[model samples]
Target: MSVIFGLAAAVAVVAALGVVVAQRTLYSALALVANMVALAVLFLTLDAQFLAAVQIIVYAGAVMVLFVFIIALLSPGAQERLHPLEARVLIGGLAAVAFTVVVARLTLNGVSVAASGRFYGRLGPFAPVLVDRHGQVQTLGEQLFTTFLLPFELSSLLLLVAAVGAVYLSRRRRAS
Candidate 1:
């Protein structure tokens, strides 16, 4: 168990570092995929089966595909060589550090699963909220549909809008 946890953590960290440090965008994206897969495996080892499934399905599957699609649409070729001047590299590093700090802040202060009432907050209105107690799917489904149906439907709508926006943005633009 500890070995699995350690290995997953190492893999995730290294892959994430590669995502940041790789010169090629495609290599970075591949590294991001590796990081996501590592995270999914970590979730599985932690017995967060649903979370692991969602991680694999949403992030590794859907979101990565979207990123790849965008990369393909935007890039004219396989490799984009940057003339790495000191100012640009420094600015890039600063931006990366800022992003890292933001993520670290969110992660550290984020809700503790060790605390009592921690459900999947991302689902928002479509809340299948389980706090390690009262967590049966049927019971949760009843609660979501009864008390939280409105939010669930809204979230789905938001997803639909995002999908449409992505499709629109990816389409070839006409000359004005």
Candidate 2:
């Protein structure tokens, strides 16, 4: 099951990536939606049902709609290649290096808390009142709501900033 799921995820990622590379903005947005859906599925397979649902609801549903809307509104048209070949090569090399570093971190270190033993083995393997007591959202929520509520609320304020920035950017500028 794991092997099959992993292979499916790999295919989804590759297909979405190819779509992103394709010239059509609409197709690229759809491809991003596909990638997000695949990620949600992957989350479900890892027993993060809440996260999976939230991912689909928030990112795949809301975010993708926003992306498509923005693409339509902005209408960034296809343009002739502007960058010189050398600049493209330099950027490609930088991107490759970044990708290599990310893959190495994922493969060797593993990003999850379990692999890192974050919480420093405090979160037990199993406990009631949580999913296998994996201590992900539930624990994080507990800590945030109880101990770190202020910071959590503050984080939501960042969303307001994002909204303001979006309005400012989308609104037409007036002549001085």
Candidate 3:
């Protein structure tokens, strides 16, 4: 399990670097997708199965798709290499390495799966909300709908605001 975690962490670090270092925008976006997937695996390694699925579904699947689509639509020549080995590139590389080291250390030292209060793995919670395969999903839904409802609604509202702002900016630019 530790070996798998290490490999996934390595992949995640490389992918994260690729996100910043790739010359082409599309390549960077693809790297970002890879990074997100590697992160999901890392989450799974920690027995955070629900978090892993959400990471893959939300960030890797939805967010990256939107990002890639927008890039493809907005910039025809986005594949062209813009910067090669600028000073910021070196700085970014150093920062990434530092960040990876910090995260790895924290994950290895601070996180403990067995210490989690909830019943994990094949164990049974058998609570009223759920009893089987959909236990995690049901718990997540309950939390989202009950405990975190305000934050969820706010996030949706935030997206709506962003969309409206984009349209307004585009129209304003066109009118100018």
Off by over 4 Å in 2: 80-89, 110-130, 133-140, 147-150, 164-176
Model 2 superposed RMSD (Cα)? 4.7
Best by TM-score: 2
Task: Report lDDT (CA) for all predictions.
Answer: 0.79, 0.74, 0.81
lDDT of 3 by residue, 1-176 (tens): 99999999999999988987777788889999999999999988866678899899999899999999988778556645556588887887799799989989877654565467454457334343453456766777777888789999999999999999999999999998
Q: Could you give candidate 1's per-residue lDDT for residues 1-176 as a string of tens digits?
A: 98999999999999999987787777788899999999999988866666788888999899898887787678544565666686888899899899999998877656465465664557543233453555544555776688889999999999999989878877745422
User: Candidate 3, after superposition: displacement of residue 129 in Å?
Assistant: 15
Steric collisions counted per model: 2, 0, 0
Better structure of 2 and 3 per lDDT = 3
After superposing candidate 1 on the true structure, give the runs of residues whose Cα lies further than 4 Å from its correct spot: 72-143, 146-150, 163-176
TM-score of each: 0.61, 0.69, 0.62
Q: What is the lDDT of residue 76 in candidate 1?
A: 44
Q: Candidate 2 — what's its lDDT?
A: 0.74
Candidate 2 lDDT trough over 10 residues, lowest sum: 119-128
Candidate 1 C-alpha RMSD relative to the actual structure: 5.9
